[model samples]
Target: MATQYDRIEPPLARFIARQNIFFTATATGDSRINLSPRSTDALRVLDDNRVCYLDLTGSGSETSAHLLADGRMTIMLCSFQGPPMILRLYGRARSLFHGTPEYAERLAASYDGEAPLGARQIVELTADLVQTSCGYAVPLFSHEGERDVLTRWAMGKGAEGLVAYRAEKNAVSLDGLPTGMPA
Candidate 1:
């Protein structure tokens, strides 16, 4: 029912590219685990063992904080459109801040040199393990499309407003951990 691999094979990469949403799970030694559902075209499979996703401006930056406190991260995707399958990538992750050369390079390579509006950082993960399981119990759902609310909100907030908003809301996690976004 389950199998493990050292890296993401080509077929797995294709499966990931077709996924409309994925989940990220992370935590520190003493902090609550953070699990989030991410959508849009923000994620990219950089290589057989590396992946990156554009971190957008959200209400909280728990993933960023957890990654900073403890590098362990896991990304999971379940098949909803076709045959039942589940994939998980276990790895260490780091957030690449804007203005850094790493961030710029990732943005260019993964995002076609255009950073989406309200994008604050890039979360890159280097996988040590990949696992696949039969998602027999998973229910099927069709991906209608990406929502534009985030984009519209970012547009309304503009650049300066987003900066201020992040400073106020994204700088700290719910457990009082610093996300290193800016305070």
Candidate 2:
């Protein structure tokens, strides 16, 4: 059975905090829908109605592009090693790029000066609906650890190199949408 909630309850918060990975889903009016798996301790719940996640540089910037076109997003998390539950956060979101004032403030407060290299955007979500369903069929898996490949690559390239790589790979989505990337 599924249950809907007006806000993120205490139990849901506990469930969210224990998850190793979460998925984000988004789509524009005409473009393809995108579902992305994200990790790296990037998510934070600001309040009952608001949440934010840091967007690291990757091969594609579909989420940023899609959110720019349409603010809708759904973030989902499932218990893989405990009691069965699937939580979904449905909301509108906007992406704040590195050059923006909001980005600076967020970084200063949350990351100080040690923000991740090649950081692209921060996605802020305003939740309007929260739901949970029985995830009895969800497979149980143990979390090993975070992958170091991306961090190592970014460290090797440094800042300027990362900017160039973003230009080459993260500037646009496969459907030719602008990712709000700085030039």
Candidate 3:
């Protein structure tokens, strides 16, 4: 069975804090839905109805493009090594790209300025509905640790190289939608 909440309560917040990874889903009316797994210690629950995460540079900008076209987004967190549980936040979101004032505000207020070299943007989600479902069917796997390949890659690329890479790879989604980049 599933239960819905008007806002994220204490228990739900704790569950979110314990998770090592989460997934984001977004889409526009005509674009292909985008779902990506995010790994980082960059998530923050601003309040009962608000949450934000630092989005690192990646192969696709589908989430940013889709959110720009349509504000709808869903964030999912599941327990892989704990008791069976899945939490989701459904609401509207907007992406604050690097060099934007909004992104700076979120970074200052939420993060500790320890973002990685590939940090791209901050995605803020305002929740209207929170849902929790029994994740009995979710496979239980032990978390060994996180990989540092992305960090090493970013270090090798350097800032200028990362900028060029973003220009070439993260500027647009696979659907040909502009990711509001190269600004």
> Among these predicted structures, which one has the highest TM-score?
1
Clash pairs, model 3 backbone = none
Off by over 4 Å in 1: none
| lDDT per residue (tens digit) for residues 1-183 in model 2 | 999988888888888989999999999988999999998288888789878888888889999889888889999999999899999999999998877899988777666634688687888888899999999999999999999898898899998888888889988898999988776
lDDT (C-alpha, whole model) for all candidates: 0.92, 0.88, 0.89
Ranking by lDDT: 1, 3, 2
Tens-place lDDT digits, model 3, residues 1-183: 999999999999999999999999999889998999887387889999999999888777899888888899999999998799999999999898887888888888888655778889999999999999999999998888888888898899998998999999988888899888654
Ranked by TM-score from best down, the candidates are 1, 3, 2
Displacement of residue 158 (Cα, Å) in model 1 is 0.5
- Lowest-scoring 10 consecutive residues by lDDT in candidate 3? 107-116
Winner on lDDT (2 vs 3): 3
Candidate 2, run of 10 with poorest lDDT: 106-115
- The TM-score obtained by model 2 is 0.95
lDDT over C-alpha atoms for residue 155 of model 3: 92
Residue 129 of model 3, lDDT score: 99
Supply the global lDDT for candidate 3.
0.89
**In candidate 1, what are the lDDT values of residues 54-73, reduced to their tens digit?**
98999999998998899999
Off by over 4 Å in 3: none
lDDT of 1 at 125: 95
